[model samples]
Target: MRSSNYDKFPFVPVAAQADACQVGWAAIAGVLQAALAAQPAASGQPVVLAVECYPGTGLRQLRQALTQALQPARCLVAGDLYRPTADIDAMVAGPLTDDPVFGRLNGLTISDFFDAEKLRAAQAELAAAAGELVLVLGTGATLVCPDATVVVYADLARWEIQLRQRRGEIANLGSDNMAEKASLKYKRAFFVDWRAADRLKKQVLPRADYLLDTNDPTAPKLISGADLRAGLAAAVRRPFRVVPFFDPGVWGGQWMREKFDLPDGPANYAWGFDCVPEENSLLLGFGEARVEIPSINLVFAHPRELLGEAVHGRFGTEFPIRFDFLDTVGGGNLSLQVHPLTEYAFDKFGLAYTQDESYYMLDAEPGASVYLGLKEDVDFPAMVADLQLAQADSTAPFPAAKYVNEFPARKHDHFLIPAGTIHCSGANAMVLEISATPYIFTFKLWDWDRLGLDGRPRPIHLAHGAANIQPGRTTAWVEQQLVNQIQPVASGEGWREERTGLHEREFIETRRHWFTGLVPHHTNGGVQVLNLVQGAEAIVESPSGDFEPYVVHYAETFIVPAGVGAYTIRPHGPALGTECATMKAYVRT
Candidate 1:
């Protein structure tokens, strides 16, 4: 495995001396016991404690631990108090709907899945009890347990949850059975619950008095209120980096293995969410205990500091920029897809903005290409018919080149793809996809008639994609607007700056640089994401001498906080006059 530099970053915490999963059950129990003891029953009233966590948190094991730790307390399993499973089925039993850009399915809010009134009444009854009462429930309980004396939020890394789910340890919202399906109706319900969980985590985590990182059920890590507050405050004050999440896909590639120093697995590393806080996990180590929470929790806690005053004002708590990898080297092509427009995305998906992305080619084998836009004078209806027919039969080959435009991609080549534009990255290419933070709005129209890794046909949004596609984005128009538009803007001793405004919608702006010595750069009151595209490594420092310099490796992505207005990039081991290339993206002013 490649050496982990995660500890060197300011945001990522060092590993605890405890187990690999960073669980400390003894410490957790001690903290809970102290809290229970501190809040003695007053005037014959009970002390109610609620442990709110997500699904698949090893509740059975946690219940045993909490019972042993909090002796003489009445432990109430929240599952028994949950509303009937019939209610969850009824809420999502509706048929799947589709918009102009994608299929739609609404997830149950806390109210839809659980009985709020019953939970509130139960907590109220428990609060009135003469003895201690503990309620172990999912995150929704935090909002309902207003009468509880203590509330704690339990969190697990998403990858851990997926692993448990695959092992048949966790089930659907109300059933012990996995709701695995390739159909849109089933997937939409899944998306709804997933999105709702994220929403709850974003809103509830900061208010939590104690945060539990239950990555390992046996030894959950606990973070006190003071330590949690301090860690969050420190992150907002400077440029922050979180631990990236990696996953394998059917069209997964091999470049990530060596480039990212990932360990060998059964399948190749397809995607790396380098800077996508939405799905990534953040580690917070306090002394010997390490806690991990969803990275988006940090953004929700300090939107202004992390996203800047202007950015926070416009986008609210949403992180405006994201950097991820789409490695197709030694793999197959990505699905031909488009994203919803700004308005469409908000109406159908509850996202503030649509996904306007660009593919910054990190490396590409000879003859590799990207399918972009549409061919001129295309028969739109006929093309739609062909795609529909292809989706019906797995053996039918998709005539991608017949409808969509194809462009040759080379190393460092950047291709702009605004929403409503059909696009896909071809094989033998490593693409660093930089875009708005809304990463899940992809409206796939075709996938080369291939099944997903699950051995099921991938769902295609043909009607939605057809309705939203920009037919005006013809091959010729894209040649001028989307293709490489590199223009030299500045130069110094051995360095020069070039503007590459690949974001056609101007949601964000990107620039590439060739530098050896110190090249001055500024955040300009907005967060900036930089990637060392060409050289082996470089260091980013504040010219004002405010913070410690950050060393970044090749193909490694890092952020420059809005607070650090001015900084410099100095390439390592570069000969004088030799250029080291780096790409930077920031919200457009």
Candidate 2:
């Protein structure tokens, strides 16, 4: 499950509300009628309906639908009860927390931005009215109206919000420079909304009479008499894909844009949240209607079903693995960073797992290099001092290259980066990062004195990084330990498999294969994540007719559930080759 701190949108087609008002309203109508009847109108009390929602959830349409669906009931916008925008701005500008990683946690939440007392007063006044009352609010509405006859929580996935932000549907919430900034510039607003969602899930969602998945502008999925856990469990049973989200950065690259045919965003597209469920959104399809859900909900709902028995027993609902992309093609280098040890992350950040990542070089420019470990003979204290001086002044005491080691990067090269190792992907490289589920624990030590794309100095955690640095991880150690130990494992007439990442310390293991015909794959009671890394396209099928065969395109990520134990992969394309390379990762035995 996602940690508490990791509290980590739409269009106008036919309003599903039209049909809903005529047909689906009967179910909701019956529930509301009962609740109202239970509390006699003779007591001079009105039915209070609370609608709490994430931003960009299209409250206007829902309000209109509810007005018609519940005759004689008044749907009112309760924005008047919220705290002033000036107050919110002041709260955001206040001092930050000591730990910069999880920044200031208090003032950035919805609780700090909304006035509960004012909302309660409004609720009281509305409850005293002659007819039923519906309160449409963005924050703090649920907490304030505990006596509401009916509560509805409107939500959208994170990727959907990013898409809405890109389409100018959502307003920028950070600094003025955010106009030129990537979607990440809205970090403050994202976290605030995240905390709000977390609160709703933990506090109000179970009691909420209805949950609206407002991802589709035309058709939203409204679950009446909601049960979040049961809904999430059902969602995991089906093979679903989280919408891939992309962002621009100071070191953003063009490989993703060219390969995925992505739209132009901020200069170039750098990172792709292909399968980072912690920050990605799940797409639930029901015929023509689509609902967006936070991907982590599945982990919390079905730990054993999704992660297998042993893995679930070990990690306890943690996804345990993540897949993402890092593009440096025609861009700058990533910051030199190190992730904390497992104990450090758990103790300091409250994370369940630490990030132990590997870079599978999908593509690399000639002479491209990766910075790994440290130089052979360098002073540890001197290197630390140099980093500190560089962070304070604009210049380093000594050249960075003098202290860091760089190795030539090539296509299909895999470099293991366990915790406590310093590493960075240099420019002109497109990397596929397959790693542990903890993706946000990166502690940057150096950024080449460059500012972020948002015009702010990127944070450097020198002290935290220095404390965890393995100084003995010099060039020789990297050559011996970081380099992949590739060995041919199995072979057949027209197929062969090579184990590329079975490092003793890593939980997730990888295997690559080149085959011309079909290659059968078994899940071994553990979930498997694979990508058609080199092939143009491939068809994944179940030999026993267990599930539908899905076609995955080049660079696309897909999952074979633990229940779907056995499957097969066959390449299909006009451009034929003797073999195609496919990479697979799963929990080790």
Candidate 3:
């Protein structure tokens, strides 16, 4: 592989004073203490501070630190105001459906978890504390003391939360199922907790006095709310990248470990989350301090500017496109799976769109191939029966070759896979997966007779797969419609552009540009996601000098917000004299 230049901790530099952010517990405590002291005494009433936290933050440790430093007269945990655990379980039972991997989205808010009487009593108790320092902290602390003298929002990234869940370090909101299966916990959080938390976050973050980065328990970072907002605003006006995370899986490979210089710990790495805003973190640089927050915060804070008006109107504060990596090189194949159709997704999971995806082969071994569609003249019922038998008995391996067609894969090959299409990348291939944002709706039909990393059989959804599978998508239809449908669209001096197939059924349009000179690009009133697929390095700059020059390396994905109207890219550094290529994806207007 070319010398790896992948940046793991990509941060956007924000214009802020040298001391705008504070690092470590000592500095953060000093800042908070100073802010509290500055507040004028209120008619002999106690100074109240509200530390509102996102679910999954280390609340116990946070409270311990603050309590020791501030010596509050009264410290109220907002979780105490929640209704009984049994009542909360029953209340969320409908949204947290029986399915292990899927649940229906609900409209439950954070307030729904609290008992009205308990909330009122807590509010009254905080008001009664006179001539003392009072601190209210927890997931719903803001609800208890909305008019506090100081509000600190302790936030955690969703990816960190997932890691904590896997380590059994935290539990879902208002629930005591810390020892439950991580998958089940994730399902509950996705359908119930996060939806509720995000709603409150949108309301609280805007008015919060300070923003706290709680991703790291030992070392915390604190910044003023205005500085955080300014960082987010700066991000949307330029091309930037969210911090990418890598994870190992049962069928993982060593491509990321070797190429990205990942530390040797896990057996192998399988998934690289490059640009998933909902699950990734965005690092904002303030002088020397680097603060990490959920990348979705940018989407929520500036939807119209990041995503164009047309996209914002359709997706509504949701990022509709996703770009990630699937590495099977030197490992086993991915689970044979199919995504739910659009209507099936909406009716069952309340998702607005399906995961219509394409696998662009970044690197492939000589004999690499992809399992796609079905073999010609295969019996539909017989295929389902085989999948069911294989899932029921782990010892028996499904005859995938008899039912699924395998196509030869090579570097730069684009394979389009709309929803309801049976597809998976074969072993020894590295794939750049471009798709719509509904990422978790996949229904695994079969796994290659292997237990998961947890030593348990992975869940299979044969019934869901059978219901959504398009029986008519045989080998011939797939060959014509899905395989490497590249067409020349435009050409300029030392540069050429080609339209790559995302299929007519998909909403994302992808274009490949091979250039040896500067190539101009426009967002066309929609957000653009691009990856440098062919070269070691390239620079993205504004044509009208609107934003600073942004550099990207091979296999690195970066986003240009819709507000960035015009930009240009050219080979830079090691790729200065090479014919570099980039693949760009955007919402088809």
Candidate 4:
């Protein structure tokens, strides 16, 4: 999750009393009620919103406090973060999900929230609702609007409950307010003078902390859907969002449109939290730090947190390339995230140019669609002309649809989006992005016909975006086997790619899968990225082996190691999986 050190807005301490808290709170609540009533309405009273624990932690407390503050001034509805799972749809009629508020909170669980288009529609519908303020514990999705917002955060007690992440994170935020004065820029400077803990401090170097030091190898993989859903049910009792930094440049900073009262704020730095984003923090790569996990092979991992100098060494010119996924709440469609021309982005934004990206279906439902590349017979000049026309006239229809390939995708399907390819992961679907780092230059050719709740037609940048599209490309193949195949690999063992240059970069390689009864995976000498595409299976001899089968999700991924040596996967439930690929990429830079 993106760490926040900024002070909570509009809430003054008791010492300051009713003055700071009452004025803005009252007026804001009234304005929100008026906005919700003006937008859309549901059959249920003021839309239903629920949370897990009302006052479990600072995050929960903040949410409950926000909800209460708003309700006295308006009639919006809310409940605890957790309300058990409900079959309310069958219980209620008139389109059971007619409430826009529920749309905001849909993806909190497995439901159809992951379906991009449906998600967009639901969000749009809720936009018309009375607004909402809700939070789902454990997950990191937070929805804030003129009406209300639902927040999900990690309880200070748990370590890995939250899913959202910023590239490199360090320091800690507990009950004490040390984080109140923290900043990403400070970490940059501090990492320079940093030192590691005398002992495991060396393990914090790179892959060591994430891969090696975690635990034993040889673990089971098969996980039931029921178990997958409740994997951390007991571990995550309370979740909270803590934005300690006030720098607006962060992705969430801008999407949420938060403005703090601190000086030298905007000029500092942000996590690049936009839907499609780039993280260029000066501290990301200082030098190179490598690791050798006890059960995993040697690895040079990405240092997401600037723990100190030893970590800084991991980032340097030799290892300059990077990759990550930026998930934004509202920005309409993304900035048609294709790579920029030449070093245009580097020259302009100083952000690297590693935009050659592809989409790995993570979570989606029936008819979940994705708009990628241009269809055949479309003239570049004509397409550009159409884009310009739409953006110029307020009432003009978007001309982008006529030129792209549309697909209603299912989980695990891959769409390769080379650099300069025009595409969007779409509104509703949750996607796993495999791309070169430097997610900075996205040229937005068009955004479907929609407007933010603020009565503003979201901004479009055709001229800027059009400069990046490599015309004549389609959402088509890279290479596919006439009839695909799978082969199991054992740890301490690796299969060779005859074509070495296939993926040549800081982190590059192709993927193939192996699954057989009692299959053996030997990670002979390196760390690998294993993305489960089909059936639920477990890894043998794994640090997390003592636990129950992880029942792999169709698209969820886990990092493995050669040191773990020859683990096994046992399929549970139905027939073992469908075929998929896993990347055992190495850092060539």
Residue range with the least summed lDDT across 10 consecutive positions in model 2: 3-12
Off by over 4 Å in 3: 1-3
lDDT of 2 by residue, 146-238 (tens): 667677777777667767766656653312333533344345454455654564555666577766677776655665534444545554443
**TM-score per candidate:** 0.90, 0.79, 0.98, 0.41
Which candidate wins on lDDT? 3
Per-residue lDDT value at 75 in model 2: 52
Please give the ranking of all candidate structures by lDDT, highest first, separated by commas: 3, 1, 2, 4
Q: Which clashing pairs does model 3 show? A: none
Computed on alpha carbons, the lDDT of every model, listed in order, comes to 0.74, 0.69, 0.93, 0.34
Which 10 consecutive residues of model 3 have the lowest summed lDDT? Answer: 40-49
Per-residue lDDT for 268-382 in model 3, tens only?
A: 9999999999989999998777899999999999999999999999999899999999999999899999999999999988888999999999999888899999989999999
Q: Cα deviation of 465 in candidate 1 (Å)? A: 1.3
Model 4, span 370-466: residue lDDT tens? 6676777778898788778777775886665678767765655555565666777554344555555543245656655555333455456565567
- Give me the displacement of residue 204 in model 4, in angstroms: 13
Superposed Cα deviation of residue 503, candidate 3 (Å): 1.2
Q: Write candidate 1's Cα lDDT for 488-560 as tens digits.
A: 9999977899998865575899999998788988888888888888777777777777876777777777877
Off by over 4 Å in 1: 1-23, 93-108, 131-136, 174-191, 194-203, 287-289, 393-396, 573-578
